[model samples]
Target: MMRLVASDIDGTILGHDGRISARTVRAFQACADAGVEVVFVTGRPPRWLYPLREQLGHSGTVICSNGAVLWDLAEDRLLSARAIGLEAVLEARRLIKQLCPDALFAAETVAGFHLEPGFIENPTSELLAEFTPAPLHETLTAEDAVVKFLAVTHSGTPDAFLAQVQPVVAHLVETTHSAPRTALLEMSAPGVNKAVTLAAYAASLGIEAADVVAFGDMPNDIEMLRWAGHGYAMASGHPEALTAAGYQAPHFDDDGVAQVIEARLAEEKLGA
Candidate 1:
């Protein structure tokens, strides 16, 4: 029997309009009521999760920052974090700069998002209000724990950019991107990705990968998808995710994740 349901938030469950469908919400609550653990695993920073607190309606654990941080949603507290050391961050930056001098940098920490000037253009008023603009090196001190590092460039498509940088930085950090067309790359500490953290978390609960059902729609979700026993890729998901997952679900816009969850619950009920 499945004991855990791990899902990616953005393209897997969350709609383009930034809302979770009623069907999806009910499916998640049903999992909880059935004594199954539902985990929202995403590349989002901890600060961006508050808006989702009410939407999800349960104070469960969120594996954010591509598995760099574990957040307790109910208490609005950080449970644990796997941060990139300052030297590693600087080294990776140096390596990437050598490959793409036009690359802009940003860092996410437990405190908030910090970016260098011009890292993002036409910043929304909300972003301008929330994000601190300062030189990344100056803003991130040796004492601060960096959760994730971001690099963006207007030079190439997101895939091409990742291809160019992955080889250069592979020895230094784990690199991936969620947005298919956006020329951005997200990096965490070496060997730190969704699967590694998710496995550890599940083990703590005495749950094995074979007892978990995972869903995702992006390259960032590949590791976790492959790690879970039953992994479903959204029909509209990136090519990499489709190839990584063993099964495919309907499109996210069509409530794909919810459809699968409801079907599984029905199967379980019938078997019982």
Candidate 2:
């Protein structure tokens, strides 16, 4: 039986418009009541999470920035966060400039995210409205440390950019596509990802990934799902993520997260 449940936000937990359904919210509350950990693991920053953290109740810690940052939402503190090194940020800036010359690029920092001109002009429908955009150097600089680079490019460039950036900066990143046409490449300490972050979090509590059941619907969530003992891919998940999971949950629009969580909770009760 699963004791922990980690889910992606954009296309897994959140409805397409970015809000969790009333049904999902109720399910989460029950998960908390049952002492099951419902960790929200995503590629977003803390500020983005600020609005939703209060609703999570007794859910587990947030695994943010593709796992570069582990935020203890209840405690209002950062339990762990691995920042991208300065030089790598610079190199990444240059790489984005070269590959997606017209792409929108920015760096994510503890303070907030900074954007380059025209970088966010074409965000995914869901993201276009939520994020605040600002000039990169104006908001963040070499002096202001960043956790990762969030790049927005036409669908055509993601594969090309990865091919080019991986060989040189592969050691610095774990790139995952969020929007069908965009990539959110996070740079952290070598070998960091949602999986590694959750592993560390679990170890801190004497828990194991095998006791976890993760659900997701995007590329970044693949590793998190694979790391869990019982991995569930949302029925509407991207192809790669779908292929990585052990089971399928309903799509986000249909309350997939809750359905999966409910089933697992029942399984746990039977086992107990």
Candidate 3:
């Protein structure tokens, strides 16, 4: 019943170590070989996605930055993108100077992340290992654009900052709690999400939303999975993600995504 398939990287397709398993790669290869349009959707920046693209070995498309950018994997280029207007964006740097003076702001661009020295220490740097950055002044008047801006406090109390800023920025942006210690504020742009990206692809191929299967395991993945014809939540996923999904896969460590794909491919063969 499904022709188009989309998957979230983190807990859905990528392993706990932030890599896709050989088994999972082969499974997705079979799907691509079977003419299923496989799309990798993630909240990661494009630079981080380059390594994943090589690892997946699939010649399809990618929806990066949680759909802020659409990349063409086969062509090795960006096809479409939606970046936050720096003018309308939350002044996380300004907020840091006022509320948490010791807090450091890191901005993600198409190139990589940039921040002031001593901004990212051991624990925080380890979490965002790939997005190391340069520094920003009161106003970052640069050529490259910023995808996302993050505030990492030296005090390790992200909630303290969120409590003070979320209400103030609520009217101007969209906020997501990726982790209790990490708050992501995505600029508002209607119809910009993994679901929308996949949906548009499905429509272009004459495949309705009813003929698609999707999988995910994060709060950022909610819309993507729910938009699929057969949506699944990883067993090791968050409670909110499980509630939003139609069924449960095994777990990332258990190769749940590969199992689901194999089963569906078998069903498709049988139907054929």
Q: Which candidate number would show the highest lDDT if scored against the true structure?
A: 1
RMSD of candidate 1 to true structure, Å: 1.1
lDDT of each: 0.90, 0.72, 0.70
Q: Model 3 over residues 27-112: C-alpha lDDT tens digits? A: 98898789888878787766667556678766667887777778777787878776555654546456546766766665666655
Residue-level error in angstroms, candidate 1, position 156: 1.6
- Could you arrange the candidates by TM-score from highest to lowest? 1, 2, 3
Q: What is the Å distance of residue 185 in model 2 from its true position?
A: 4.3
Give lDDT tens digits, candidate 2, residues 1-272.
56677777778776546566778888888888898767888887876775365545443488888888888777767776777776777666677667667656777777666666566556664454655666665566567657767766555645555555566656555565566555545455567788888887777777788888788887777888888888889898887888998878887778888887777778778988
Query: In model 1, where is the ten-residue run with the lowest total lDDT?
Result: 123-132
Highest TM-score, which number? Answer: 1
- Tell me each candidate's TM-score: 0.97, 0.85, 0.81
Model 1 TM-score, 2 decimals = 0.97
Q: Which stretches of candidate 2 lie over 4 Å from their true place?
A: 54-60, 122-143, 155-168, 183-189
